[model samples]
Target: MSLIHCPECGNEVSTEAVACPNCGRPLAAPAPTIQRRVIVAEPRDDGFPKWVIAPIAILGIVVIFLLIAITRNNEDEANRTVNVNLATQRRTAEPRDAARDTSPPNRIDVPSSSTTVNPPAPPPSAPAPSYPSSTTTVPPSSAQTVPVDRASVVIDAKIATGAGAIQSVKNEKFYLLDKDLDAILADADLEPIEGNSLADSFGLAVLYPDRYGDFRRDALAAISKHIKYNATTGGDGRAAIKNVEPDSYYLFGITKAKNAFAVWSAPVSITAGENKLNLQPARLNEIAN
Candidate 1:
C-alpha cells in the first residue's frame, strides 16, 4: 500500500483512502491536473503599427488638402486684384472717351449765360469833297514824215576772160564805200573787206551776188548811218541799193574764181525825196599770176 501526505492536514494516508483517519477530514480525489504547452513568442523589428500609419496618412492627406486650399485662395486673391484694377482703369477711361466724343474739334467753349455785346461801329467818314469836273483835251501826237523819194542805185557785173568770152558774174561779193576805192586801197591801216570792223565805218553796204537781190529800207538806212549792212544778190546778178542818203559812194566787187576785184565810183545826189541811178555794168578781169 502506498502512503500519501495530505495537503490539508499533515497526516499520512493510504493511496486508496478517500479520507484521513487521524484527521478525520474527508479528502477529495485530486482533481485531474491539466497540463498545457507554453509557447515563447520572438520580438520582431516591424515598422509602425497599422493604426499609427493610418493616422499619419490621414494627417498627410489633410495637410495636402490645406496646401491646395491655400494655393487656390492665393490664386483667387490675385484674380480679384486684377479684376479690380481693370475695372478701375475702365472707369477712369470712360469719362475721357465721353469728353472726346462730345467735344467739337478746334472750337472755343463759351459759357451759356454770357451775352456778347459788340460796340457800335463809328459813323462813316464825311463824304469826299466834289471838285469841279475838268475836261482835259489831250493834244494829238506829231506824226513823223517819211521821205517818199529816197535815193537808190542799181548795179550789174560781168566777167570778161582773156578769150573775149563774156559771162554774167555769179557768186561775187560787192561792197559800197563812202570814200573812193583808190583812197581805201591806198590806206595801209585799212583792213581787208572780209571781217573788217573798220569797213563798217567806211563801207555803206556789202552785197553777195548769190543770195538776196532785194534789200530792206531799214538796211539802207543803216548803211546811210555808217552802220553795218549785209546783203545778198539774186541769181540774175542784179542788185539794187535803195533808201541811201545824199552822198558819194563807190561800188566794188570781188570774185573768188579768178581772184579778181574791181571798183567804180559815182557822185550820188539824193534829194529830200526820191532819186534813182542806173549804174553801167562793169567787167572783172583775172589778176596776173
Candidate 2:
C-alpha cells in the first residue's frame, strides 16, 4: 500500500486519493494525452462528374437518332406509294387514247353484184322536107325610051329693094306642099302667111334653106295632086329648093325685114337633072294687126 502526505493538513493518504481525509482540499485533474490522426482526401475535379452525366447524355442522343430514323422511313414509304399510283393511272389511259387517235375518218358502203341493169338507146333523126323552085320572067315592050331616073330643082332668092345693092336674109324656112296652087293663091289671106302656119295648115315639108337647098325634101307626092313651092333667103342672101319632081310648079314665100313682111310668088319648071331659077323679089308691106 503506498502512502502520501497532504500538504495542508499533513496527513497521510493513499496515492490515488482525490482528497485527503484529514484536510478537505480539492484535487487537480490530470491532463489527457492528445493523439493526432492524419486523414487524406482524394483530389476532386472542378466540373460535373463523368460517371452520372455520361450515361444521361448517351441516352438522350440514342433517343434523338431513333426519332429521326422513324421519320425518314415514313417519308420514303409515302413517296413510293404516290409514284406507284401515278404509274398505274398512266398505264390505264394509254389504250383508250391510242384507239381514239387511230379511228377512221370516213366509211364507204359497197353494193351487191346480184342485180343487172340495161342502158337506154338513142333516138332517130327525121329527114328534111324539099323546097319548091322559083322562076322569074320578063315581058316584052314596044318602045325603048329610057325613063328619067332622078331630078332636082334649085330655087334661089334675094331681096330686090329699089337700091341696086342686094341684101342677105338669114334663118328663113321654106315649105313644099302638094296643094292646089290656084286654090291657095285665090285665098288672098294665104299670101302673107307665116312659116309655122303654113306647116301646120298644109302639112308642108319645112326646111332651113341656109346652104342652097342642101337640106330640102327628097321625095314628092304623085303628079295627080297640084304642087306648090316656096323660096326663102338664107344667111348668104340665097334660098334654094332642091330634089323636086320634073313638073310645072307654082312658088310662094314671105320674108321679114324689121317689122315689115314681103310676100312673093312665081312659076318654076323642072327637067330631068338639076334646074336652077332666079325668081323675082316681092314688095315689102306692113303686116295686118
What is the lDDT of every predicted structure here?
A: 0.44, 0.44
Q: In candidate 2, what are the lDDT values of residues 43-112, reduced to their tens digit?
A: 9887877688889999999999999999999999999999999999788767744553454311111111
- State, as a TM-score between 0 and 1, how close model 2 is to the true structure: 0.31
TM-score of 1: 0.31
Tens digits of per-residue lDDT, candidate 1, 1-289, equal 8888877788899878988888878877768889999999989868867779888989999999999999999999999999999999889867755654454322111111111122112225422222221132222111222233333444455544556565554544445666544344335344333233322212212222211112212333433443222133445454545555645445544333432333334333433322333334434323232
Residue runs of model 2 more than 4 Å from their true location after superposition: 1-148, 162-164, 176-182, 185-233, 286-289
How does residue 8 of candidate 1 score in lDDT?
A: 74
Q: After superposition, how far is residue 152 of candidate 2 from its true place, in Å?
A: 1.6
Stretches of candidate 1 exceeding 4 Å from the true structure:
1-149, 188-230, 259-267, 270-281
